[model samples]
Target: MPPLSEILKTTTTPNGTPWLTSARVGDGYLLRYAGMADFILNGAGSQLTCWRVEPGVSADTIRHLVLDQALPMVLNRRGREALHATAIVTPKGACAFSGPAGSGKSTLPASFFLAGFGALGDDCLPLVEQNGSIQVLPGYPGMRLGRDALEALSAASGVTAPVADYTSKRRALALPSAKNFPREPVLLSRIYRVVRPKEGEP
Candidate 1:
């Protein structure tokens, strides 16, 4: 079988950039970009999957893919359980982070991870209803953090890794575990909205 990178490079979309060209590995899809990669797994039959890529891809790019492409695909393909939220989860429901671009949504989640909280999602997290309760899909193994955000987190968490190895326009970073790198999808839970206050507005 061709390596996932080779598979992606071999395929192309109408615009020339590889859109949905990926290889199926186990229960997940390994997506390879020119300089980065991520995995998408089937979350409860929902086409939307938790995304984790090598540190470098822009968070804005991730947003565009998830919101513009992936989310819609899930809704159309798996309407039974559609989620619209950016969140992380604990044993008690889900904590969502909602905000616009560059609003620290990704940073907050990374902080949570360094603080020992499990990652539910970073850029695009799925929300679902289970047993009349809202649930969020535990996101992929890691997230992309901004430079300043990484520095702050390092100070707080007292855990530092080479940003050079995990830095990008979005400053990507992996969660604090190797097992969290799932080769499959996950279920959904709650949603959180992360945002930055307006200048001088509180």
Candidate 2:
């Protein structure tokens, strides 16, 4: 049982939360999120080791945290271009939707899923380049779409999209909580960035 302190330097974040810190640990990165899940992502960004905190936390919450933070960070450091994008697998190939916050990144991919394509993930897509080819490494299979987005999908398809999980103003839009993600990597085809026109212009 090697303690994190022996393997890496420690630091504190002043964000009034228990997300202690993840530092450059020996040949890897260490993470302590919400003072619960203690984990390490190996230098290759291919392996992870995790443990529960004293009182334990929901595995679902830990999974979400790892997707949003640790895994992306590790992959980015390992030379993959981690995009702030959502991705879907179309018949042609994998397509990415990238933009800043509030740019409908999640909604667009969800639309593709409804149109019969498969969702790679709704956020945190990593592009791995090899031998002059780019591949879309899938993220967690889920879409965090707003209420209106879900409603629109339901109405258009005439099927009530199940809410996999609850958030503040959105629901985790996936069958049985998005943990059922596909693993096959798809070749990169196109990436579309969302842009909105001025209110009075269009």
Candidate 3:
């Protein structure tokens, strides 16, 4: 991996604190998440390398950042559309639920998994135009959820580990534990925008 040099882009948290930075390094790009991890993606988006910056950073956290965050940046640069959504493979095809943070994007798919429908992706749903239609690509087969949601979903038996040491969010396996997780692309049939119920509106 090439060494990171001058910063090229910066992404911040909801409260405005810098969260991730992208910098140029020879023919590759370095994506740095302060105190968490650094990822180097080659210019062609074919190769990737990463390491944790802080001690005690779990491999789960690094893997999460790489797939859910860094890879999306690379895909976007390659002209693929990545959405903040969760997709499930239903009888009709793939149904995607998309919205801002705190929406039911992740939870919705967990529920679908319980109903025997396979989850296609987690929070980062990547779409590809294929054969004159849109298709949903499979993401990592791990879903992160709060303790309460995890408990309700599967009695928390599928919980593997916390997403990060600093947070209580845990990853649950979506395959055998949750029933199914499709590995192949599914045709996109519908998209629903998930939203929290307004006051007194059910």
**Which predicted model would earn the best TM-score?**
3
Off by over 4 Å in 3: 1-6, 174-179, 198-202
Clashes of 2: 0
RMSD of 1: 9.3
lDDT per residue as tens, model 1, 110-152:
6666666666555555545666755555555456566577677
Ranking by TM-score: 3, 2, 1
lDDT of each: 0.52, 0.67, 0.79
Q: Model 2 Cα displacement at 65 (Å)? A: 1.3
lDDT for 131 (candidate 1)? 68
Ranking by lDDT: 3, 2, 1
Q: What is candidate 2's lDDT per residue for 11-59, written digit by digit as tens?
A: 5445443445766667667776645667777778888777555464555
Worst 10 contiguous positions by lDDT, candidate 2: 157-166
